[model samples]
Target: MKKSSETAAADRRLSTVARHLITTTTNNEEEENGSFMISSSPTAAAGQSVFSNIVGAPEDPILGVTVAYNKDPSPVKLNLGVGAYRTEEGKPLVLNVVRKAENLLVNDRTRVKEYLPIVGLADFNKLSAKLILGEDSHAIRGNLVTTVQCLSGTGSLRVGAEFLARHYYQHTIYIPNPTWGNHTKIFNLAGLTVKTYRYYDPATRGLNFQGLQEDLGSAPSGAIVLLHACAHNPTGVDPTLEQWEQIRRLIRSKSLLPFFDSAYQGFASGSLDKDAQSVRMFVGDGGECFIAQSYAKNLGLYGERVGALSIVCRAADVASRVESQLKLVIRPMYSNPPIHGASIVATILKDRNLYHEWTLELKAMADRIITMRKQLFDALSARGTPGDWSHILKQIGMFTFTGLNTKQVAFMTKEYHIYMTSDGRISMAGLSSRTVPHLADAMHAAVTTVV
Candidate 1:
């Protein structure tokens, strides 16, 4: 009986220690405003409830589509929400070249798992700058441009925004009215003011060039303007080359800063040079601009998160200082980028055969997305779906702004299990010939039956 009593006492002691640990951790987390916690007792659960007041946080509109799609058990369910590329069979793709690159990397006896520099792999940074700025770029040749490897396009953008917010003379940033949803959030969280410039025209289902020009013209001198280098997201409406030249003139004339977000690159038009023309124009004019370039779409390195940020300055000395400051901005956030992805990119880009193969594979992906666009448009036409579906073909890159209202999107989701963002933006890469008919039928039904 005494031994049993001692065992019970030990159990009580352990429970008491666990409870104390939980309380102490919870207290520390609360003091730091940490977003995560665990509870071990009823009292701890009560404390967790207070911390869980994050219930008020709104769902991410873009990611929420995937969440709802996953919960649906319907086999016919379609997810055209996020801008991820998929094969015609609706499966994610990892390019053959990427596989070969990985094979080379894994087999290399000389390679080590050393940490990259704070600015990232030097070879990756140099190649990335040349890829976006062109091999013959004068600024690059003059050593007036600084490039740093970053965590894909979003991370590059956030790092650039934070630096601009702290050092740039202007804090106000003007973005497209319906840009990628995260643009505003990224800039705002970086402590910059976000403003919208009119971009899409609902009437024509195209670029509101006049409205865009007016908005940028009215922006304060030296204000930062975000430009999608190619393949504008959500709407997929990009200004023509002539329009880009005009925009460049206006921005330069007004002394406004240009910040290019080149996420699509070769994935948009199947030619890296063609996609980079807009950015090159500003660089050619010997003007200062910021560029965030991503390989997620082009290299099929989505999860690998490889990208870079480049800043053009008037002199090499200024470029050096800009890069030093960028390191300061990145130090506390993420000390350095991952080595594997950067190594893969550098391996491909530095080699002639692998680089050629990469371009071919990139073109194939772009061609597939283009094919999906044509198939979707044809299906809609065959079904005699109401309204002009020409916009599907007119749009470029991985998305088509279907212009479907929120109610129609809801109806399609409810009745057809075809999931897309409420804003009617659909990832064209997500569609296949097999699924086009289902989407077409849903559109036809929604348009005809819904008021």
Candidate 2:
């Protein structure tokens, strides 16, 4: 009985201590204005949010297009706002070679999930360098090119920009005035002062060569100039070989640095070599430049997010040093890229048969876009659409600048359930023969009624 009484006394003492601690904590919380918040405190009102004052942000202009498209219940709704390839039946395509490469990778039992070095896959880097700069490129032969696997075209661009902002003397990057929607945001957030050089002329539906030359000529020497190596986006306007040569000479003479974004290399002429002529021209001059390449379109590895950023330097040592610094920049961002995508790319690029097959497939996609372009043009002609729709054929790659204004685009969306960017850009690859007629009708109606 004495032992039991002792245990009861101990329990009472513990209970008293616990009550005292609770009272002390409550007093401290009441007295301290910056008291630590316990989310489950009884004082907290049920279902109340701590972020009540934070406002919702508007959706991104490009990505939001699809979000809006998905919400529309209309059966006839068409989404031409995104820059992705669709088949003649309006399905996303997976290249035959990509499937073959993936099959080989899957069957290889020896393939292990190993973390790539911060620089990424060695074979992918080397093959990517060769793919962009050519097999006989003196830069690669001389070991003056540093290549790193990046997260598709946009990631390559962002990595390159961050590197330049930290290392290069010039913090200003002059992008084409009407360049890709993400270019300005990418460069600016990397701490580079974003500027613009005139590129597109809406009036002629062509390049503003004189304006571009004037802007680049006046830019400070050593300032970086962004170039769409081939298949310029939105407008689909590309400078002819002669114009590219003149632009190259002007840039080199002015000592301006060129940074090429080659997202749609094989889409322009349906030939990789021919499409890369603009970038090859710049590299051929034996000057330093940056090239970011994406395999999303060509390899149809959109989900894989495989791409490369290649820096052509003056000497081997400089390239090595640049690579080391690039690693420092990347280590904090993503640590390293995934191996599956790089492995698939290496499998296809290393084998000659697969490479040839890939080119043929790429050509087929391009040809389909060409057919759609012609059909759309004919459809517009049949409707007698108000403007010169000839620009449809002139613009290359996945996108065509339709010259439709914001109000017209809204009209198209409201009345016809056809969706595209407010800037009047439509994805040529998103079109098919079956859908061209509806698009033509929408355009005719938008132009006729939305005055």
Candidate 3:
């Protein structure tokens, strides 16, 4: 009896301690790293959840928009928060060219699911490099670029960040103030310091060019700069070619390293070459830079995760050495990339007929997005929604920063069942002719009623 009483007392003490620990972990975001916490209680350890320390981590601000949208039962609910493209009927798109490429891959009898090298598919790498750098690129001609297929844009960025953290001379990276939210965490966890430079000017709903110049000018020499090759996210504002030239000169003059993220390569103005102008300008100068390209947006290969990382070097020998190091970085992480997506991209890119078909399809998608932007603008204007809505037409790419405050966003969500990130960025790709009026109505109500 005495021993039984002692055991109960000890169990009570442990329960109290466990409660305290759970509270601490919850309050501190302990599971942000996907922490696996063991339970302190014998009962929990023996038969129940061992992960007692787990706090329900917050959903991703960017990705969570979809999560919330999925729960809404409203028939009229529109999810402008999703980043993927949607048809006019509000369905996820699978490009016709992508289907044709997949058919080619599936029918090829010689192809196998063998593991690719750490540098990924050789054909995919060569084609991806050519696609971004152009056919007659100086870097391509001189073999000064080392291209590696990665697990789409995020994977490529992470791999590149890891490589830069390990090999690059400077560890500090300057990203735009309002970049893809993932950028900061990707670099920070890679053991690099991430600082922000002003990019979006909310007051004018456009790029703060003067602020951008000041910020980049102030960065230390050899610091890494993350540039959205085209179709800058969130705000959808891109620098003019002349502005890009100026920015390029400043970056080169300061000897800053350029790392370009080319996610929406063909979406900005419906032409791949036009969208690639920024990255090409930097490469045209025969200087060193890094580029991460994603097929998620352009080729609609979201699930396949097709992308590549290209490191442009001053010389072929430097590029060769960089490839060796990149291989080292990749081998330990994911070992090698999957072969299926790479094959599809390669098949489409290398063939002339399919390539031509892809460009036309890409242009059509871009034209539709451009049309949606105009429709949204006209809808707002037709209602006399009292704001300068011209930015809607001006901001290029899949998104538009609506400049809606959090309260306004919440009001729209609560009353109208419209969903988007709290920061007012909406995926124009998600909007279509059927849903424009509803969105415009929500925007009008939110702007006039909430604020």
Per residue, candidate 1 scores C-alpha lDDT tens digits across 182-293 of 8876776565677889999999999999999999999999999999999999899999999999999999999999999999998779998999999999999999999999
Can you write out model 2's per-residue Cα lDDT over 1-451, one digit (the tens) per residue? 4444324434543443343334323332221211122223333456876655433444567778999999999999999998899998889998889889999999999988989999899999999998888889899999999999999999999999878866777777898868787887677656667788999998999999999999999999999999999889877999999999999999999889999999987888799888888988999999999999999988888889999999999999999999998998899899999999999999999999999999999999999999999999999999898889999988888898999988999999999998898889999889898999999999999888886
Give the Å error, residue 27, model 3.
Answer: 9.6
Which segments of model 2 are wrong by more than 4 Å?
1-48
The TM-score values for the models, in the order shown, are 0.89, 0.89, 0.91
Winner of 2 and 3 under TM-score: 3
Q: Which stretches of candidate 3 lie above 4 Å from their native place?
A: 1-48
lDDT of 1: 0.88
The candidate 3 region of ten consecutive residues with least summed lDDT is: 27-36
Error of 3 at 241 (Å): 0.7
What local lDDT score does residue 282 receive in model 1, on the 0 to 100 scale? Answer: 94
Candidate 3: tens digits of C-alpha lDDT, residues 349-410: 99999999999999988999999999999999999999899999999999999999989999
lDDT of 3: 0.88
